[model samples]
Target: MPELPEVETTKTSLLSLLEQTVLNVEVRQSSLRWPIPDDIQKLRGQKLRKLTRRSKYILAEFEHDSMLWHLGMSGSFRLCDHYTELRKHDHLIIQFEDIELRYHDPRRFGCILWLDQNSQSKLIDTLGPEPLSEAFNAEYLFQKFKKKNVAAKVAIMDNHIVVGVGNIYATESLFNLGIHPAQPASSLSFQQIEQLVVEVKRILKQAIDLGGSTLRDYSNAMGENGYFQQTLLAYGRAGEMCVNCETTLENLKLGQRASVFCPECQPLKKVKIAPQKAIKGSKA
Candidate 1:
């Protein structure tokens, strides 16, 4: 699946479409994760005004309406000449005078939908702050984790807590801080949460700078592979020597996702706090 960085990279590559008039809209396969809305044809003759990303979704703002695009599990977008041969999975195409933009998905799990310029979907409305935004600071994360006992890794991956921390990035962030993936959410000290917030932002910026990770079918909108995978220190390194301590890295399942970590580096330690006693003069 295309995570935040990959989606952001795709969004950047697609900036070429801005201010370009749409000459045609083709729906070779309307059946995707969500059906390609018949109204998508309305984009024909309209100008693409802007492009932006929210979480893993891409928002294409046309002159009068907009499109909410999600690059599902195996989806990708590429630009090719108008006369280029279409691949078997090129489900949708938007043709301009000079080139064509195609959406391809082997699994057909992506989506292409049209929306009124002023309308909003529950998907976008419900997402938490962007991980890179200042609103997702440590104080915000600490409040969300209070009284929650879920594994720290699972909590961070929650979209309501912070958008776009997918399995890969979440695993990488925790490993960077030596925080055990299975540690209780509420047990994390304030300092740990602060460091986690910083690490998440730093790692995400680094990933985006490196063009995102090309795992499986993920690629930039230009069909170029990302080089971020080369810098991975923990993810997909199970049973391999830890780059920091030479100890063999270990793998375990958390929230049904594979989590890789060094047993010596990320030990699960839950702090126990003794209950406070009531003061004699205080109301019982």
Candidate 2:
């Protein structure tokens, strides 16, 4: 599944190519991995003025803003010239005068939702803060986690806590902060929570800069894809040695998703410890 950065990247690319242009939208296949709206054909000749994101959604707002689309798991946006060859998986094709926007999905989890955008309705309003925005920071994440006993990794991944911090990012963020994955969200001090927030933002920004993690089907617009696939430290490397420490990484299931951590680097400290001077009588 593409996270916020990937979606944002897609939106950025689409905006440059398709913004303010009238669209001849066609659903090459309406029934996808998820339900496609029955009135999908109404987008024909609609001028898309807004290329915006609500949570992980890429919304191209038409003149009325009443009709919006949601790109779900495995969905990708491609900005192509009209002459560009179409692949078998291109399910939704939107044609403009100079360019074409194609939606391709191998798993088909992407969906289109029709809604009244007046106050965000159910689709956009339910999401929490964006990680990169000012509303989201260590204090916000810390406050949200104080009431919960869930693992810190799982809590951050919860869209209810903060949208777009997916499982892959949860692992990466915790790893960067030197926080063990098993730590309970409620048990974290303000400092640890703060550190977690900082690392989350930094890691997400870095991953986004690298065109997002490409463990699966994800690519930005212009067909430029994920570069972090080359820089991942702990993600999908269950038995690999920790990059920070020589200790082998450990894998466990948290929230039924694979969680990886370094036992030596991110040890769960039940009690604070300070090392003595290696049994020397005086400081050497």
How do the residues 162-193 of candidate 2 rate in per-residue lDDT, one tens digit apiece?
88888788888888788888788888999988
Clashing pairs in 1: none
Q: Lowest lDDT 10-mer window, candidate 1? A: 113-122
Off by over 4 Å in 2: 18-20, 117-119, 270-284
lDDT of 1 by residue, 169-190 (tens): 9999999899999999999989
- Relative to the true structure, candidate 1 reaches a TM of 0.93
Predicted candidate 2, C-alpha RMSD: 9.3
Q: Which runs in model 1 stand beyond 4 Å of their true positions?
A: 116-119, 271-284
- lDDT accuracy of residue 154 in candidate 1: 94
RMSD of each: 3.8, 9.3
